[model samples]
Target chain A: MKFQQSQEMRNLIAAIFVGIFSYFIIKALTDFDIVPGVSYIYNLRGPLIAPNMITVILFDWRGYDTLGEAFILITAVLTTGILFGRGVLGGDVSEKDSTPIRPSTIVQKVFAAPLVFIIVAFGVVITLGGHITPGGGFQGGSVIATAFFLSVVVYGFKKNVFNLSHNSLETLEGVGALIYLCLGLVGLGLSGYYLYNVGADLYPYLGVGDTATRLFSYPDSTNAGIIPYLNIGIALKVLSGFCTIITVLWGAEKK
Target chain B: MNGSEVQFWSFVTAALLMIIGIYAIIFMDNIIKKIIGVMLIGDGVNLVLITEGFKPGGIVPIISEKLYNQSPGIFQEFADQASYSLPFALVLTNIVIGASTLAVLLGITIKLYQHYNSLSVHEIFKEEKI
Candidate 1:
């Protein structure tokens, strides 16, 4: 009875149960024959919208789903802001100053500034080139956010290259979300649907041809339509959302 | 080497990940460890999804300009060789959601630590009048 009541014994029993459950799951999944249809169709038709299949799928085919996912991120950021926003929304009289803090050594400071620029540049490239490349908004946004974290955590939010404030970050997030919403609204206006690929001129309902295409499409080899613009919106939103969360969590004291 | 072999191994890896995650969630006393376990579970499910999209010998789902310029028959061949991309899109969205959620959870954890001055789950849950 004593042994059964112990944490170790509880762990063992839990492990055994999970193992048995997964064993059956694995067997069923392994034996099942998956006949895929939508993916095959998407592979054939995906390039008509964009050369990159995954990007097209995320931004064009299932843009609604992605919108919901983005809302989840935005909501989470707001939740964190609420959790740590003691002086932010309503609290004490606040005056904020950027702190001047040096790294332990001269060599570290010299490298940090230039490296941050390089990282931000790389993230921009990934974000912009997402349509014709492997990356998308999410990956590129996180890459940029990583740079923000490095600089803010190491050099304190007072880096010589850039200064970030909560208000500015919130504005960026709002603009990002507005971009996405407006793009969808344009689709609704043109083709009577949300997030229709107007650049493709693929939809039968979108009777407006060359003129519409010229107005909306990204200046690239293929007509990725609103996808690239959507990528930019998502990247900006994600970058700011993450930055906001970190700033709140860091609980920067006003000097 | 082949489709089934790769699929089976991937499933096994996913199963192992989930089992470890479950154990960590149940056995570990630290809130951070439990959060880590939740992440592991998410990763395991993502692996299973991506593995489902794999083929025996498949290329990336991207179509290059050169391939597009090729004859219609060649383009069709590219389609046949390419892996399913829907799961990849799902995984990408999930990754972003997971990261943001992790940040939120950790922020909450920090506040809890400040209040309780303890990271132990047992201590956090101990009966206290207040």
Candidate 2:
């Protein structure tokens, strides 16, 4: 009886805490207006391009972290391939049953085309406006990868998204990673730090002040040049890397 | 004490989440549940790091009116202010990493499900060990 009473008391305390938290969260959102745009909305005259700041931070200021993220995806893909690749599929009746018996959904087929087109268009927008706006390589790449995922789920893995087979995706992923490394090496070769402003010396092409004429007194060299290239490389690498995992999982027979 | 209290609550919530995740990993029988626990732990750590970046009574890191005295041609002081862009960026990158890790785990789980009809984590090891 004592144990049951204590358990009930604990549950009551937990419920009270949760209620308090929910109340505060709702109050903050409605009364305090503690929204995501607090940085801008509460205080007028925030940066005109807040999202651009978001993008630059993702790709340039914190490029090393982005590299680490890419490595995580790569590691996951590699691990998946290793433990559950062809070796596991061989000589197993269980594997044969892994393939889905259900046909493709009508709704999926209807939405897949538009979804792929829109995502690809979004990727283009990100790639083009990355320097000036919030979207960048990682964001664009993920968007592109989502298209592949949509196609696979909607039209069956082997039908529409055939270009990115498991073997092909693996190869693309390796190439994507290599491209990122190459861009970083370019920075180190010229600027002493990996992924450093190889773009600074080369910033003028993107309409950033020419490094030759104006240093801009900014502590770091202008990164207008290679930042775009880095963005593209990263976009390709991440896009392929994400797609690779999704493709493999979709294609795999269960056993 | 207002902002400080907020920070304290945030930290406590993060810690509690982490503790729950640790317990889940240790006790959960299913591999998928274990993966979810790991993700919970990652989210808790990320929340702590994000909360650590917030400065009490500090204005947004953006070059806005809050930092400036609004006097004409007096932008010198605000130029040196620290920015919150780094933490925001870290959160985005961490999110991507977390999602990718989850995808891989799901893939593995699918394969595991194929090999064994059940999702119980320990059973696979037990059957394979002998």
Candidate 3:
């Protein structure tokens, strides 16, 4: 058909155009410095501010952006639930996903339990060590959620190691979001800023007492005050949010 | 390869990925392949941002107390030698956003399949009523 031919021609043209444009753009990007950027400034101040540069930018400088990022995951999970007949405008709530999950082999069954524990432990270390090391809450939480995935894949969702109820996962997500909001509110109450790192090392300048600082601060040499807390909060939210999504997609039982 | 060379190759690979993804999205009839195209585009852009963060002979942008205990005055040196952190942060945020969007897209695809009983784009379009 003529229409089909035109569609194919258009697609080819678009692909060629995109390829050429990207090549030029990359050439320009590499050849030109494009003025200066804040990366160097972040590097200079990052050591004194926080040991991990990305953590400082995400938690301290771009806290609002991080909040939006977490909210996106939550929104996606809710949308998935809606698609599965858990919300308004749904006729019947009896549909199940046809993903064809096969029965697990004996070897997989034997190894899955300990593997879940080890994965969860590694995720915790990543979440708690965000201030001084790489792999923050988002990465850590995703890692932890994989353990849930593994368990479900190997043992089926009914008897999986992390067969938490829908209500519990939703509650955990809310708790995580609240932790993040309350921490920002704490900063707002003390200083005029929302996510200001008002822990001991810097709070003295704000004329706050040492006891309050110690209370706000975690035991990190980077003076990374609320970053670790934020990490834990984001990790919890991301973990629960991702798990909720997978559970819904894998087909939840009718309530 | 040097940093610039590495960046060039990375950009080439990213562009190829994006091109293939766009091709899939436009020309492929299967809905699942289209979804994968969306993912491929996101991955290409993420790669570009990551390549932009690369520095020639750069060090990791981390400062630890253990490293400090050995030499308390390595901050300046570390800053000079470290790769760009801003783009790294941006890439991290983008990855999460991309994953969330992918989840939403797949959900929509599932709903569509349930309603239409077919994964072929042309078949669904032909079957659509006014």
lDDT of each: 0.80, 0.62, 0.79
| TM-score per candidate | 0.89, 0.68, 0.89
lDDT of 1 by residue, B23-64 (tens): 678778899998998899889888888887887788899997
The CAPRI class of candidate 2 is: incorrect
What is the two-chain DockQ of model 2? 0.19
lDDT value, candidate 2, whole model: 0.62
Per-residue lDDT over B44-72 for candidate 3, one digit per residue giving the tens place of the 0 to 100 score: 88987887888878878886566556555
Predicted structure 3: clash tally: 0
lDDT of 1 by residue, A105-203 (tens): 677667777888899999998999898999888778878988888777567775534587888998899899889988898888877888887777766
Taking the candidates in order, what DockQ does each have? 0.53, 0.19, 0.53
For model 1, the DockQ equals 0.53
